[model samples]
Target: MAADGPGKKKHGVLFDVDGTLIDSSYFHAMAWWQAFRREGLDIEMSAIHRRVGMGGDKLIQSLVPDCTEDMQEELKAGHSAVFSTFWPSLRTFDSVRDLLAACSDAGLAVGLASSAQERDLEVSRHLLDAASSIDAWTSSNDAKESKPAPDILEACLEKLGLGPEDVVFVGDAVWDVKAGAAIGVPVIALTCGGISEAELRDAGAAEVYDNPRHLLEHLESSMIGKLMTGSLDA
Candidate 1:
């Protein structure tokens, strides 16, 4: 596709749902923990929390190197089943709806660059009820791999028909920053995902906000704001 097509989206914003937009990061960690336990891996919660943004396949390999292919599948299935029970606990952060609407009003395309599966995204979207502001979104199936790799972000870019330079990624994990860096996208990190501001900065985040509300409040001064206004030379 051409970069300057008649209907091409220019500036865009890609959001990571689990932490940046919702309060389910630890829930996911717990689900993964139970999944591993069911498979007799007995992984730690903190360890699983740190790897929450990674795809299930990569996460299983990272947490349990000795896991066989069949075991990996079983663990993932277990995690999915366990996670489904927490659907009622899923909640969006403050100003999540307003944040997406703000981006739309600012003349930028918004996309959900989540590494979650379709079922998970469906639950999130239903909870958020802000799909009208979203231009496009991607699930794990859209990418061959997930975070800390650029596959998922690349898939979002393709879906939105926007170039890497035309977007800013908003996420709440260090893995999100690494994934953005791998694809030449600046990540606006959030500490709401249980990661520290220092850790996010150390991971190469362009800026770190406390949560969706904080970012939304300072949108005009943010990298997102600068990009939307075309004031950022980068």
Candidate 2:
């Protein structure tokens, strides 16, 4: 979901939904866990968490490199099956609403660029009650590839009618950073999704924050960093 409001419009901001803006990261891990179990594979939660931002196809392959392509599909299907059953339990992070509000209040267009399915993205919008603050959003369903590829971010930019120079992307995973870099958007790495600050930086994140609250606290400085620090925003 993207929120729209009347305000200044010099720039736009894109957000990653699962770990960056909401608390669904851990649930996604569990969903993947249940999905793998259904396929008779036992994997560690830590391993699953590390691959949380990857698309379903890559995710299954990352966990079980030896699995055949057909098995990968079955595993992905199983994971989705298990995850859908647990959707009712999902919740938004506490800082999400404030973060979006702050961005909009600061005269930035806010958008959601998540790798989650369209249905899951809708669930996030419903859970966060964030229909108004996000100006645009793009889901995995809208792209040919997911994170680590520029497709999702590209889709969001096209939908929002903004150039890469006019947007700043925020996310919680290394894949997010890679995707942002691939598209030439400056990325702010948020630690709320369980990725380390160093990892985010190495992945090409321009700045790293502990969570949305911290990012909001440093918005002017951080957002400015994105706008001018030798990237698309420049």
Candidate 3:
């Protein structure tokens, strides 16, 4: 990991890509479901949905604990192939670009702490059309572990030259909440990923919103705003 530069911002914000910025949670779940079917497993979509934010290896292991290493690799490949077919239909939530720009304009370094593959992150960035506002981003390859482990968040922080206390995370799943918590970063959870406000709150989210538009609408009062103004405590 790289060290912070003298001119680096004091505060930053990290965002999870799949369900938080892009509306692809269900697509991921379906792809996993298809992959499981190919391997003669019959897991429910609801179960898969709940695990969407985890890395592919972890997701496969969690869903199929008895799966061999070889089988896990195959399942992961199957999911990637299936998920690629849905790329064209993926869409970003309302005001995602504006929300990112708002954080950047507030002088907050914006980093994407996604557990997505490089190709998938590229597609999401293309759809967001707000690359100029992003100071840094992390793909699965950037970390040895994924969400619920804090590795990806740590990687993003390194990339942005920020610390956990200097930033907040925005995500759409319990795994994301857990990941942020592990690193002492407060998470602002969104229900746009199909998770409930109650579940997100229970999972340790600092605040809950309906989607990116809702957060953007309340930007001045949100955690991102607090971080920017140095009003939020470390």
- Cα-based lDDT for every prediction: 0.88, 0.80, 0.90
What ranking emerges by lDDT with the best candidate at the front? 3, 1, 2
lDDT of 1: 0.88
Taking the tens digit of each residue's C-alpha lDDT, what string does model 3 give over 1-234? 222331558898899999999999999999999999999999999999999999888898898999999999989899999999999999999899999998888888888888799998889989998877888888888999877899999998888878888899999999999999997999999999999999999999999999999999988898888887899977
Q: Report clashes for each candidate as comma-separated counts.
A: 0, 6, 0
Tell me each candidate's TM-score.
0.95, 0.89, 0.96
Q: What digit string (tens of lDDT, one per residue) describes model 1 on residues 30-58?
A: 99999988877778899999888888888
Index of the highest-TM-score prediction: 3
Off by over 4 Å in 2: 1-10, 224-233
Give candidate 3 regions above 4 Å deviation. 1-7
Off by over 4 Å in 1: 1-8
- Superior by lDDT: candidate 1 or candidate 2: 1
Error of 1 at 4 (Å): 18
